[model samples]
Target: MALLSYPRRHPSIHLLILSAYALFLLPILDGLELGGDGLYREILRDETVLRLKELGKVIAFSDEEGVRFQTTFLGSAAVAVQDVLKLNSLEGTANALGEVRYSPESVGSYVEVHIEQGPVLEALHYPLAAELVLTLETLCKEPNKFLTYDEECGCFTEESLAGLVCTVGELLTWPSASNVIPGQVNFTVDIRAMDDKVRETIVTSFSRLVLQRCDDRLVDCAVEQKHAAAATPCDAELTSRLERATRSTISSMAAGVRRAGGETPVLMSGAGHDAMAMARLTKVGMLFVRCRGGVSHSPEESVMDDDVWAAGLALVNFIDQNAVDAAAATAAESDVASGFARPHWSQAAHQFGCNRAP
Candidate 1:
């Protein structure tokens, strides 16, 4: 891939969101801002929704590895996002911007966690809006709901999420804390997984955990739909990488273990992306430009030259040797697809099949 003079392999949302922000200048009169996604409700006449908090995990057990062996709580990130954006909180609107109905039992009390969005190109110099939201939402109380619940604690046990790890890679706990309304609230640790398979598994597990809270009823929490990217089948090289991920020590040490059901260990994210999304569809991978102390989703999100160069160097290494093979393979396939020019592996294109010709 021919990169610009900039070194970063992956562009940040903080940097790219400017295009989204520029839309605010349009004359729709209201909204037209990127950070103002909440305004989409007004633009579309959707009502605002309120955020409910009612779930948290009280560790039932932990192994020597210190991994939480059980889940005592669950909640919908969608609902929280809805509240944070104040999408449905608006009164008297016909349609709610973020309306959701679910057994409050499913997702326990609400606590804040980071929603990583915006461009990955931005540096880490600015305030991390995601973190700010994390700071704000965790402090929100459910008034009378979440603080009270009755259950036979000894009966419920959390299921291991071995299956979910297939789509994601790194799962981590941010035991970091923040103050929302100073002197009032703190935060809980978050376990984040980055592998596509692992992420899918985590999402599935989260759904089920909340479902259990629903006491066996159909719930309508906000769900993540597949991204509308130009998706195609996963490539052979990517398939091999996914297979290796399954055997990786990380997968073996997961909380729960399940047998694969002929599903690919890798998956494409509908939204959250990095090299993972690109890697799943093709041999394309991404290198993240930093978020200056992890800031994003605000106008002030940022990063630095050093970080961009680091990302670029990693990207260079990934393609340096594969470029020639890529082109040779393209040309070697006796029959090139209609008008497509066979590429040299050395090209190591960003397009991979993503921008394959129109």
Candidate 2:
């Protein structure tokens, strides 16, 4: 697997890095975490970690002992920061603050590259998408139902299980055997939406419906909220860079293939990502490569090499662009601090909907 490595040498004053050991790569690599975040983190570890550490990069792993050390450490740091900032939270603010302090040693931007998990890109004929919104996921589970099953015909019909309020999947019946009736059934429901209210309503309504089904069937049912995550918006500035980088990369890679016209489409991620967590501190940008048939989280999930190559180039471009933008901003700040007046700079900022100094 190729890694995106820029800045042959560490140029930033401080580089705070976060990595996770990949347990999700079991299918790809035996005993080695060589996929997902593990792959990218390993790339840095092999090519850049030691080299950048000498230059003052504080690299931290998200997990060490089945615990997200990154979040815990950052959370503690956030508490300290909150105390220093004289901010008190009556409803508990530890998690929020930790996400803020997780990357204190950084002076660079955050960028993530992922395959677009939906069919939007394929449908729109776009090679890449800059995600604007992230949808929240709410997982609910129904457990242990005593149901009658037909032995000869492999079918179990539960009349009371109809009229569900939300789409449910991963339904399993306990003691799944052809010889015996299933005494229990377990199922999971996954609900997602861009709006929090919608998600909440669905969850509530779905839970109520499950209870109604149980009551009507005279079957005892167990339901629980497995997991819930709120939506997080991508950073505007970082998202813009992502768009620019994707456009530049796509244009450069457009020689052989027919080009998809129009500005890179801004898409909403129906899936959650690590970016949602990192968004607590610095700005985060994401580049979504088009996947084959928009299939994801399954064996059918795939992407064309061109789209993958486009994504890689987009990432490299974004990194380079971020450095350039940082330098420009620093220069502009220096000029302003040194009392040098540049009317055109102010005019340019105004034209771009940026704040200008009086």
Candidate 3:
């Protein structure tokens, strides 16, 4: 399912969660089907093109020769979400696509429970992360710039650029043969940080420096931002409650076993998730479960059975506690409305969902 909503007495305070499975797959190619020679061709159906035009949207297919069409990792996930939620359509207009859309009156909060995709939790021997930040994906390309040079390191080596993690996850070079100078160099930079200002500064500085260097060398350079997201912080009250629930669950599990530290590390997730987008609609929070060797998106990725149990138990405890508190707060508000002397108490009912990394 793309999104699931659990409503309580107060519809405006209900929680909405985006499932991880719903955000895992990318968009499927339009006309290709199973068991056909045309499967290799990247083609869009005429009807699909007409549908896009009727919606006032443009559809452009790549002109690259001999390019095989393949589903992207998260492209289909976005489309599914949009279809389910009726997003991106003009407000107050009927949906011409003939798909049922779910529109909630209000969403008080969003909580995502997912596995930690990186090695940080494994390295620290922690089972969960209660905090996550933002992710920035950038692409830089230069036709004449050679990849075997020392100048490229200048952007990362600066002292002011510290605290930000940068990875060259994808690199492409023309003339794939060995012993030949690369005619074109293109690469992707994945930059992430807890501070948006720091992240933007690094991106700006890196792009500026690269452009200046390319200009000096008389080489054509282009820097394009593929994606960007602002840091999404968990609600303070919700985070505190989650931490308490996690600690209680851990303490209960460790009753017969020896444990080293009693503290759960608050880590900044370098990876992106649906929680980032859901933050636009409600207050967002996250719970991360540790994985084996910090490996993810690979066949080797694994999580301990005990950790999984603990995550579930912790979530149950959190929901139980939240429900009790919300009920009490609602009663208090009711008492006040009835002209009885009651202490002011208010709380929003939260919804939970799962969102995995792409």
Candidate 4:
């Protein structure tokens, strides 16, 4: 704000201040640091918990910054701890503050709080994501389901198979998007939860979706689904290993220009992250530091000054968008995503959206 201060008395000083302000805004207009925020790290775990709430399994909380996951039992205990400490927003604020500020080693009796080894997003994005994910799998098994293939339509459908692909959201969810990472895209359907019924449903639904898509497109599909299926849920045996979620984000830093121009999608990743380490994830996307937006594994988490200011402005814009309803958007996007070809049984283009009726 001081940057906006008036300095009418000193023209030279005013010039310098103006120069500094311009420098701070450089990243915003020219480019932005493209790194992952804590959001991706927690998407699966968080969404899993929410989806499984109907079952016996329970998750205490989740955020985009995947960290600080606790099952129903532990989550209860943590809530008690929060009440005892009179900590409002304890889970998020404490962890967030811990990461940004360095602290001294526990000094005698007093707990010393200082900046963590590095920035919050870079340090805990992946680890927190892992914890949430592992715990979630322990809860259940995944189900795979697909629509019955319609021989007459030559397309998969429950009743009728002939029609446009769809105008609703396609929900092009990529499993292990990383599989396509340095190689061909790999997909997986994960099911976890104590409720066998739910697990079966998830697996059934996902498998069906994959098969349906593949069948619709004449592509072969496979199922690589698992839940914390082992006898022991928490033991290392039940572990769910995932790639560092930030790789994609870090690589995206090159889009500083796109981000500045608002061409970049300011969307929230439905993933888990090392957010629990910093303890906050829900709105962490709002805090992208903008400088480094680099590889999240390094101690030197940073961003250019310009990037930070740009992100600051961008954040405000993004918050305004939250008011938009997701279901509506999903429906709209599904239509857009599944621009299926014209639906016909005789002869026509077979692409996702090739032929048309009306």
- Give one digit per residue, the lDDT tens place, for model 3 in 259-342: 466676665665555555555545567777777765544455577755665665566556555545645655666755342222
Error of 4 at 29 (Å): 30
Worst 10 residues of 4 by lDDT: 20-29
Q: How do the predictions measure up, each by TM-score?
A: 0.27, 0.59, 0.59, 0.21
Per-residue CA lDDT of model 2 for 1-358, tens digit only, reads 2222344221111123322200000001111122222232334233322332322234232221112221222222231243322232224455654553534344344555666766667877777888787654222211112223445765434432321124565778879998988999898787766556556766887789989999999989888886566777888987898898777666665253344556888876666555555555556666777776665444555677556555545554554454455456557666553432222322222332222111
Off by more than 4 A, model 4: 1-264, 273-294, 297-302, 315-358
Q: How close is candidate 4 to the true structure, as a TM-score?
A: 0.21
lDDT minimum window of 10 residues, candidate 3:
18-27
Best candidate per lDDT, number? 2
Output the worst ten-in-a-row residue range by lDDT, candidate 2.
21-30
Clashes of 3: 4
* Higher-scoring candidate on lDDT, 1 or 2: 2
- Candidate 1's C-alpha runs over 4 A off are 1-271, 274-284, 330-358
